[model samples]
Target: MHYVESPTSPLYSSISNTSFSSSPSGTFYFDDDEGEKSDEEEEEPDEEEKNQSLEEVDVSVLKTFLNDKLHQLGEKPQMEYPELDLIPRCRFRPSDYILIVHYVINKVLNYPLPCDWVEDAEELYNHNPELIAGSS
Candidate 1:
């Protein structure tokens, strides 16, 4: 019996890289008729499972969530800058967002970036302290 999956489920992620010929270990299978359909079938991938894809979906969700929370926290009548500055600044040449992305990629793929990456980002941040201040 083949497992029916939701098209939108992010858990399985790019099955193109997967070969169904080999049974997956620790897989969650479903019968042809199940209560809730796997994202592969429903076309609605689960939010948590989507994170496993190590695709942009997870990063975007995290970034968006951070942005929303940051903005909400920074809302004040005495605000000096627009609401946008409340979030972490990503203005340095390398940019914090880029670092965040890199970190995410490294963590997801279990790969490590060059040792200089952190130093470079820190240097850039030091050069543009205003961005960090504004974000706060």
Candidate 2:
């Protein structure tokens, strides 16, 4: 990601936008190239790495267990839920059903959500002890 100083903007005179500010204070402008891919080339993996599956072994086990549980529950698991009928379906994109499947698997495994939702829940109860007791 390259930052080119616009000569027209007078705010930064000596600081060409390319020069990341060494200033140690209040307001400094820095260009953010959030999505720019760098020019560095990535090395291609060998045949062994290329043959590896996207689904991890643990994830595969979880999927199998979930499928078995769903069978026992007498509800056939579907790739897409009935709710997704409202949206234009695509072959590549996962529908609401896929999200639900993931949610259930995580729940059954007692796995916390990626961004620490369990901590947030605990914090919520801590902050509002009365609300927690009352809701239950």
Best by lDDT: 2
lDDT of 2: 0.43
Best model number under TM-score: 1
lDDT tens digits, residue span 1-136, model 1:
1223357643223332333211122232223243445667544555655454333234444455434433444433232334344446553333333443556445654556655323335465455565444543
How far in Å is the alpha carbon of 18 misplaced in model 1?
31
How far off is model 2, as Cα RMSD? Answer: 22.8
Q: lDDT per residue, candidate 2, 1-136, as tens digits?
A: 2223257733224223333221222222233453467799856656655554423225554465435434544533345434444423234334333544666446544677665223336455234444444454
TM-scores for all predictions: 0.22, 0.21
TM-score of 2: 0.21
lDDT of 1: 0.40
Model 1 — TM-score against the truth? 0.22
Model 2 spans with C-alpha error above 4 angstroms? 1-59, 67-97, 116-136
